[model samples]
Target: MDLLALETPCLILDRGKLEKNISNMHKRMKTLGVNLRPHGKTAKNIDVLKMALEDQAGGITVSTLKEAEYYFSHNIIDIVYAVGIAPVKLDRVVALIKKGARIALILDSVEQVKFVAAKGQEYDVEIPVFIELDCDGHRSGVTLDDSLLLDIGNLLHNEEGVILNGVLTHAGESYNCKSVGEIRDMAETERAMAVKCSELLRKNGLPCPIVSVGSTPTANFAEDLTGVTEVRAGVFVFNDLVMAGLGVCDESDLALSVLTSIIGHQKRKRWVITDAGWMALSRDRGTASQKVDQGAGLVCNVEGQPLNDLIVSSTNQEHGIISNRMEKDIDWDSFEIGSMVRILPNHACATGAMYDRYYITDGSTDIIDIWYRINGW
Candidate 1:
């Protein structure tokens, strides 16, 4: 297959690879017997989202209301805004709900519960609410031991227009695990925590129908998801250096990459300057703390194969400094002034977020299609 001439710094999605990654995630979730409600925040492209849900019940998790609106407009009715909502965001949620979108909102506090309940009444809409549980102190979720879980659940259950749909948590800390054993332990912890929370809600006579546990690391290694209804993982569709560093998915499984072209070079410094910079690739150095601190991203040839130890060592807003990861010698002529290069991102979601659309190809030089994305909050 011949490569197509494309604009520099465009986000590329390898179609063949994209399907393989989606299939792997769905297969894992099926074996564990849980619904694979993939997080759409990773690609933010409907083409990818459509493929991710094609083999399963269609439910997606989103990080922004704009995403909720975008997917809803595209006919994906079952959506979960995974991020906790501010009271002001209810109007946006309600507008979608009123138009036939089943958007679930997540929250963690009693104050948020009250705010959701109040907004539900004002809009006369039944807001499906998921209480966020803190599985490992990684993010915004409330801890399992907090009394507010019961308090918020009770309030939602008793409220006129609000329904306590379930509890969801992301074992984000699982990403930091150094071994498969540690990820396994964290996955068990994530499952146990959500199950225990479900038990607590049921014990309190509150309806807890859904138990959601997420984060790619925990989802991949979760030995038992017996009590969980659904698993939310986004990055698996476009594996990143961070996931590769954690052994969640290999760098070869990275379907999303930034398409760049060599613009200049510094021979003495062994740096190959490219048109892709922090703006093309995101500023998320997720692998910095990992054992392999991929400066910006791992560099690949135009065919998307790794260029030995080459990586985007540094970047300015519109320029990338690609060099050997170990800072060894470089053949400056190898990367000529107009040659194309592909840079795999440290974080797929963050990197993909930088572009408005993805140039889709199947490891070929020619573009299969261009898929648009919904960016922003």
Candidate 2:
């Protein structure tokens, strides 16, 4: 059961680091006076999810209905389908509702609202839903001043089968920040958006209660939660290079990494290829605008410590190019064929999605256990 003895090209999660991250996030949310509905999209592993839900009233945010089913089957309730629920998935959403799972779906447009309301009526169910607001308009969400909020609220409020629960916003822009202070500003801005949107709903006579905000970058640096009711941050459960770049967590706090072995060495190129590639690491070339560009990922020693002068540099399908800051000074023969190494990913969600199981370890780097992951649509 030694980790070093385990096969290469595996996923290893540090037990201590994982718990530290969980505890850190829990304390931060408590201090901010908001509910921490950790996002399950990052880890997705039952073991990791369980650690994330500690003393948190068992609420979670998932990107897919399958994840909802997986967590619900495990007895975790109070789920939020963070993504916009399409009409095709209404049946599944209805099924989860019937089973007493307190669920909510996101709506950003009038067309979507009408469709969801009609579906809810046909299913003879009261669908608790949240209106997705575009705080900074990073991706999918309605604008703060968009008249659609009140319009959709009024429509769903009067509907016999639909209930407008609250407003939800994700500070996805927070990830692009360069410093903890910048992340703090993003958090405040997210809270402000949630609060302001709630006010707009209330002014229009809609019973607005929940004000949810998410994104690990903001969650870690956010100082005040005066109006937010709940916070939904996922990657905090397993810190990644993306989070580390924003100073949300130390590089050492990262719990997951891609395990690879040296496959070939190009001494002249001053680089060594590993079995791990974009398939093992991910194609998430995260926020290259930052001071440090972690190509595909940061190269780490087998024990999960980043090699200061080394980086994955470049990656292609089924291959990774490892090189040091000064390629000329890089020692290629130092890493011969069969030498194992670990690469810390830029985005844990995307990278973790590439694997089917996690090779769990207690930081010994000599003993490892495998925790299978759920994949597919």
Number of the predicted model whose lDDT against the real structure is largest? 1
Residue range 95-122, candidate 1, lDDT tens digits: 9999999999899888888888888898
Instruction: Supply the TM-score for candidate 2.
Output: 0.97
lDDT value, candidate 1, whole model: 0.88
How do the residues 1-377 of candidate 2 rate in per-residue lDDT, one tens digit apiece? 86667677778888888889999988998888888888888887778888888764678999988899998888887999999878899989999989988889998888888888888889899999999988877998888777888888888798777899999999998888777788888889899988999998998889988899988888888889998999998988788887777778788899888889889987788888998888888788884777778888888878777788788888888889898856655665567688888999888889889888887788877555678889766
lDDT scores of the candidates, listed in order: 0.88, 0.85
Model 1: lDDT of residue 96: 94
Predicted candidate 2, C-alpha RMSD: 1.4
State residue 210's C-alpha deviation in candidate 2, in Å.
0.8
Stretches of model 1 off by over 4 angstroms after superposition: 1-4, 55-57
